[model samples]
Target: MVAIALCAIGCQNLSLPSASTATTPVVIKLSGWGSDPTEQKLLKQVLKDFETQHPGIRVKYEVISDQYMDVIKTRLIGEAAPDVFYLDALEAPFLMSQNVLEPLDAYINSEFDLPDFEETLINSFKYDNHIYGLPKDYSTLTLFYNKQAFATAGLTSPPTTWDELLTYSKQLTVDKNQDGRIDQYGYGVIPELARQAYKIKAFGGQLVDENGYAAFASEAGLQGLQLVVDQYQKDRTSAQKSDVGTNSGSEMFGQSKVAMVIEGNWAIPYLKETFPQLDFATAEVPTINDKKGTMVFTVAYVMNKQSQHKAEAWELISYLTGKEGMEKWTATGFALPTRQSVAQKLGYEQDPVRSAFLAGVEYAMPWQAGKHPAAIMNNFDNQFVSALLGQQPLKQAMQRAQAEANKLIRAME
Candidate 1:
């Protein structure tokens, strides 16, 4: 009965055992947000492979599709959450502090190769010295540029410093029609908090205070963010999604509306499939304030505290995050493997485009800011965009955003 329901919703080509099986196997429920069709197919294959190895356990996978966090939180509060589920690093601190997630420290052993995982990726899920989750995969931002655009602009190489990037943007910006409308923007900008977190740190500013309140309005933070505003308002060389009439920076870059964009590994496959004829290459993101910085995003498998199948749940989590399963899951490049051994085996570091992303892992900042990042990010993005559009001064805008974010955080507390 459970297998039928699972098969009806996004589980492809899953074959379950008949009722005549010698022993009734334990059913372990797993849940995650839906991804691209190719990614989903790969994940389902991983789950099926696990089931084949452990005939005593039946894995039931479900896709929440939308409003993933809200659905998971509701199910958790009602004690009906799946035994294991995908938890983003952005949400890890909040959930780990709530006493709702099971600590996996006891379940992991030396042979599990705990040291094989990336230090930063594993540390994101660590709270009070207990590991609550294990990162399945991670991605870091890289500079994506169109080779043809660079050639047309007579540029020889991608920018390595912020000053060079600004200069290059001017050379790359063009208006072929001379109708006072830009035919091609020099750079694509995504002004969201996720993409800009490292900017705040570049100038010695932080996203939150020691008490977990919003504190990005410091002079240091404003100093770093000013570059973005100046590029948009003064230079007019960079554009947002609405300016280009595209859905995302990736789409805008793929459409040749922009010459360069800061994107992650996921965009590699996307650009290949959607714009095969476009000549593009990647480089490490330009340095700002003479500092190297980029953002890292990762998702982990976390166990539910109230789950009845804790043992089986750990088995699934360990296997999926283990070297073997991660290799198979990340083999197709939907996401980069988090394990060092798997990364070595996959040899993505040698790939031209991917090597640029791999270079960022050493200095990338995890996309997390305490437990209330969602609230902080929401307020900051709203006011930051206003500042970018010249509605208010950058300093004033950040001050207002910080105040509003803290008020909401207090209310939530």
Candidate 2:
């Protein structure tokens, strides 16, 4: 029988004699994104709960905010990476290629509810027909609108089609404290490659070619992506990138500066906590050309291939993704449960905000995970931003993005 060592406060090995006196915990590092105070607090409770149940492990958690990929790559290459880290579905291809992430298929089969997970979530982590991780949380984009703003605009329901969205946005936009200036925006768009993925997919445009090369330069792709940009520059109903600092849309929505915005499920908790006074509700993100959809951003818990503590790590992974741990970890309303059984058990699939989140799961296009995504994203972001700023025709921008992405994609192959 494999022994489960019990320790507390930290993850340092208690087996060593003199090491026991060390102030630092037996450090098992965990890395992820998010420095939001509420998320951090929620994590603490989960960690504490883990320590309480399994006494021997001490976790040293770190949030990688800036140059995230570079830092993670450096640590992983140096073998100093965290024992448990967040693996995005988009970057799974790159990380899996590095041969660093351990396969957790056996663990899932042996210890957990193998059939209980949603097939869509399970398939995201599968590489070479092998499982690399267990998804801990997921977010799908939705249309968040300020209720009061809609009421003021004399609108009762949110827009459903592309034309209606444009008209509604223009109507809802106002110069509330008009000093010959427009203060409130009708809508907002995040002009980055990472966030705008759903635009292409919504209109049946593929981001990659049949051979898994960059393919977002198609006529359909340009049409889908341009619609959002046109709403800002041409239609004058969307917020410009510089209108709000940092996360323009999220911030604008929180302050009621934008009437409608496209953000993920995480934004719900954020708005609820940060701007409690704001009257906000969510709906499915409006479609392009009358087709409905959005994006998926998900993170999974992956095991370290070189872990000296594989047995222990597997135990943790199994338990963390198991019915009990998943229930506890997702209990705080921080994220949407990826497992169908868990969703059903928690009634998350039926809850208002959560149900809207759940509704979008089937339609959400996965965020890019192609190898050399950094280079591709760099090209895509620059070109896409050009379209957003009205500096380039949408066709030219996407063509440039697709060509650049293909070049980088070819080099990696």
User: What tens-digit string does per-residue lDDT give for candidate 1 at 95-178?
Assistant: 887777778998899999999998989999999999999999999999999999999999989999888999999999999799
Candidate 2 runs further than 4 Å off: 1-29, 56-66, 177-179, 244-246
**What is candidate 2's lDDT per residue for 93-190, written digit by digit as tens?**
76775566777766566447777776667778888889998888788888888899999889998887778889998898788787866777888778
TM-score of each: 0.94, 0.87
* lDDT for 227 (candidate 1): 93
All candidates' lDDT scores? 0.89, 0.75
The clash tally of candidate 1 reads: 0
TM-score of 1: 0.94
